[model samples]
Target: MSRVSLQNPIASLEQLAETPSRKDGISEQLEDDLRSFGCELIQSAGILLNLPQVAMATAQVLFQRFFYLASLKDFGIIEIGMGALFLSAKVEESFVRMTYLITVYDHLLRRIQQQSTHTPLDAFSQRAYSLKSMVTTSEMQILKRLGFNVHVQLPYGTMINYLRILGLEEHDTVPKKAWNYLNDALRTHVYTNYTMPTIACGAIWLACRDQQVKLPTTPGGEWWLLFDAQPSEFQNVAAHIQRLYHRKLDRQQLLSHLSDTEATLRNS
Candidate 1:
């Protein structure tokens, strides 16, 4: 019920284009695709590493915030994502060992490449050492870029509290559906753009709409006014989550998209 003073970094699409992360050669579409891809990488790696959902969500927020401060062209998503997850472990107290983290990432990278190399990476090998260094360096870079302010305010708790206040907490399906929406919303940049309360309200709105569970909407102010959300913000959050389902991107898929764009540019 209390507002957290921490806020995530926010930037408009136009502002993002001007940031260091937007190099002259990279297309906005390519960057957007990669953002989604990076978040997916963090989420997948988190799950494989047996990290809690809160850690994964916090990592995604860190990954998203870093990209806003840096450029996709300048950094590899694999490294940054791993760094985010590693740092998030410390922040969230999930405490995954570096060796285990790198091993899972190695496995994930191979899977993404669809490679036949199933040989486990040796912890003493040069490659493992390189990966460890890469992740550590990225963690430092992220800390510096964000000025060591990595506090993230998640919307899950807020959503539940709002539902209870609205007398919808007892509904079996609404809470679960809304929670899923919040999870998917992390794949996009909605967290950076909207406050925690707004995101919570948006998820609730989507869930209620899907279930045909209407809330009180007095003329003086809509139901959302009880929270800190505007009706317009709900549409944007819903659209972001909807677009995530519509466009699925992985490392290889994003590379293909970039290749197609380059080819089209050559013909132009």
Candidate 2:
């Protein structure tokens, strides 16, 4: 029996710095870019597939966690991403058919390539059969590598509850803005490093700052303390989330780099 925990354990800065990819000589920039790419795939594909926010968030977290255990040289990002999305849908009880997943991913890849003449993956094609096998295998690999402890405690519900507690749930734009910030934060490493309360608090802080709305701050302590989040910690979380928007990934270059890496791996 797999022991399901309430949430995945958070890693320290040092542990995060020592990812398998880093140890494999992959540059920090490329690793970060890859993570962002994987998250984008999950988010865009989820939106196209009409998956709920929580389900998409779960897939991104799982995808991040899996790469921490397996290096980019060993596992293809698309395969692990597809597996993560497939497994996450099941985990969140928003079950989507495997065929739909395959089609969506194929469409996304073709769209990225801007190939107008591309055809949908035929169900009986060898490529489709191989991809399905890879997705299932990658799913099992992620489960085993993570010790069957794939539970992710997302900040969405916590953010909502915190907003209600802070009397900001009904405030104009605060709730929606905070929720949007939380969604964007999913693309960053903050999800793996910060606690749920801290993330929720950070999103709220960013939203408040954006809307120029004041949160209760007294000499006694900050309002976020009531939710067990420290001022410095949540502030840093907000900063990390903010920096995510400043990045611009070169998709063609990134794909070429990965291709070169795989060629080297195969030839070696």
Candidate 3:
């Protein structure tokens, strides 16, 4: 429980469009790489620290949300992600000691330094920012950037509910695979732009359809129609996630989506 004065009250949807990350201080490609790297680091750190998947998933959303208001150029990936992971643990009621994340982060730095394809940035190793102080400070910045909106609705709950309704809650295997899909979704923009139920529905839908989990024959409607959400957004979520692993195929799928948008624009 922490209270900080709101930097600015959210007034309109347009305000959400004005993310600081779109400020062009960093190239889009570079920003994507850094953001992806930070997200991966959190996953690795979470595993190393024995933190649960929900903590890492929540941390990923906070990481993505914070960068929208702030800037990657202003904050190093290690600091932003570490702070997000720490704060998320608390927010999700899974308290993690700061020492664990900072320590795992240091280990991640060492691994990155050893990797031949990448080099650790100077800021990555700066002694000044490596300390715990940087994480606590970045936590405040995350709150400020988020306008103090820290209550995130994670897909875990909805995923469970959906799986239960489908009679696969305790059946294991596919549901677990779908759960992994939900965790992996944090790297995509769907979490920030779409509702949790939408993303959850997408994950389960993909697991059943693409991943070969059986569905009941009696249900005639589209699987996503079961949830009260924008099915288009769920499709968007599915596309982005499938793109992460099936880049070659989903890249074309992504282009097809863009191509459709262009065609609609032309008709307009």
User: Which candidate should be chosen as best, given lDDT against the real structure?
Assistant: 2
Return model 1's CA RMSD, one decimal. 5.8
Most TM-score-accurate candidate: 2
Which of the two candidates, 2 or 3, achieves a greater lDDT against the reference? 2
Please say which candidate is ahead in lDDT: 1 or 3: 1
Ranking by TM-score: 2, 1, 3
> Residue 261: error of model 3 in Å?
39
Expressed as tens digits, the lDDT of each residue in 1-268 for candidate 1 is: 9654567666677665565655546666667788788788888889888899999999999988888778776677788888999999999999999999989887876676677868997899776877788789999999999888889889999999999988999998999999999999888888988888888988998899899998877576787888867889887888888887777555565666444423432343
- Where model 1 places Cα greater than 4 Å from the true spot, the runs are 1-5, 12-14, 218-220, 248-268
Per-residue alpha-carbon lDDT of model 3 for 1-268, expressed as tens digits?
Answer: 9875323122246534554655745555556556666787888998898888878888888887777777664677777887899998998888787766666776666555454454433344444244467688888888887876876667788889988877878865768778888877877666777777788888887777765777653366755567775667777888888877853223343233234323432353
Q: How accurate is candidate 3 locally (lDDT)?
A: 0.70
**Candidate 3 Cα outliers beyond 4 Å, as residue runs:** 1-18, 115-130, 170-172, 217-220, 246-268
RMSD of 2: 3.0
Worst 10 residues of 2 by lDDT: 259-268
What are the C-alpha RMSDs, in order, of all predicted structures? 5.8, 3.0, 10.6
* Model 3, residue 182: C-alpha shift (Å): 0.3
